[model samples]
Target chain A: MFKVKVYVTLRESVLDPQGKAVTQSLNSLNYQEVTDVRIGKYMELMIEKSDRDLDEVVNEICTKLLANPVIEDYRYEVEECVAQ
Target chain B: MFKVKVYVTLRESVLDPQGKAVTQSLNSLNYQEVTDVRIGKYMELMIEKSDRDLDEVVNEICTKLLANPVIEDYRYEVEECVAQ
Candidate 1:
């Protein structure tokens, strides 16, 4: 099997309200060292063994569903998962 | 500055409806090779130059706000960011 780790984040130009809220919360907690925060999505895909080119499959999935290309950017890493 | 990347994942025992939905969507899109999907959160914190131990601060933030230890697991990577 393949373990695919995906990260989706808002584009630099987009404002992230959730990230702002978190930063404010941290500041209120006395963590004055925190300058900024950006919240995003992380996903793991347990892909069954397949002969197809993994890169192509993953790219399609991320572009089509995992990320909203207009406002978000995504990247992924794939690793072979040893069977038990 | 320091760039900290945090990944928060649901515990193995927890049910992930969002992941299930994504898996179903992939299956419908003919990506039959996908076996399972797990969704999580990714956050990036930009910390200003500070004298405090970063690991300790990150640990506290993750536990107190970034993740619910009862249902999720979180890990982070910290890197120094060169000033522009």
Candidate 2:
């Protein structure tokens, strides 16, 4: 089995309200030096079949189902690397 | 500066659509053994202050803003240990 981790976040130029709220709260806690915050989702997936074809499969999953390409960008890493 | 990380996830019993969708995608990727998944939010905060008052402030931030206690739960750790 292989372990996969997926992280999804809005494009850097996009505004994040949830992040902003958290930053403001942090500032109030005397953490005023913090100027920016971005919130994102993390997912861990366990794959049973990883026969050296991880990249292709992970790409297909990310593009077709894991993330919305238009609004968010996703990056994933497998516990072990598979050749192209 | 100090660092604080906040993780928010649906309560264990709550159903997570994002998690389910990812799990299904993984299954199609030949990761059939995967049966469950959970998606969560992570926030990293950089604080300027590293005094003994970190807990009081961190607690205030979590309860007041870091998380919506009703539906989300958050856990945070200070880079440096702080006394109660």
Candidate 3:
């Protein structure tokens, strides 16, 4: 099997209101040292070994379903794993 | 400054309906090799240097704000970085 970990984050140029709200909440809670916050999504996928190229499968999945290309960027790492 | 990356994930025993939905969507789209999916939150915080211990600050933030200890687990990595 293969273990794929994907991270999807907002584009740097995009406004992240959710992140700003979290930052304000933290500051109000007395974490004044926090200067900024950015929030993203993390996903773990377990895939059975197949003839398809791992990178191709991962890239297609990220582009099609995992991220919104216009506003989000995604990257992934794949590792071989022993299925339980 | 310190760059902190935090990952908050559902506890192993918890049900992840969002993940299950995504998995079903993928299977319908023909990515049948995918066996399991788990979704989580990823956050990045830029923190200014302070008198308080870094670990203590991070731990408190994770426990009090970033994660729900009853159903989620969190881990973080901190690195020294030059402020822009």
- The model with the greatest DockQ is 3
Look at candidate 2 and give me any clashing residue pairs: none
TM-scores, one per candidate: 0.96, 0.62, 0.97
Interface Cα RMSD for all candidates? 0.9, 2.9, 0.4
Fold similarity of candidate 2's chain A to the true chain A, as a TM-score: 0.82
lDDT of 3 by residue, A49-75 (tens): 888988898898889999999999998
Chain A TM-scores, all candidates?
A: 0.94, 0.82, 0.95
List model 1 lDDT by residue over B1-84, tens digit each. Answer: 999999999999999999999999999999999989999999999998778899999999999999999999999999999999
Pick the winner on TM-score between candidates 2 and 3. 3
Which is the leading candidate under TM-score? Answer: 3
Off by over 4 Å in 3: none
Using DockQ as the measure, what is the rank order of every candidate, best first?
A: 3, 1, 2
For candidate 3 chain B, the 10 contiguous residues with the lowest summed lDDT are B75-84
Docking class of 1: high
Query: Candidate 1 or 2, higher DockQ?
Result: 1
Error of 3 at B54 (Å): 0.8
Report the lDDT tens digits of candidate 2 across residue range A33-83.
Answer: 566677877776766663557677667777777777887898887784353
| CA displacement after TM-score superposition, residue B47 of candidate 1 (Å) | 0.7
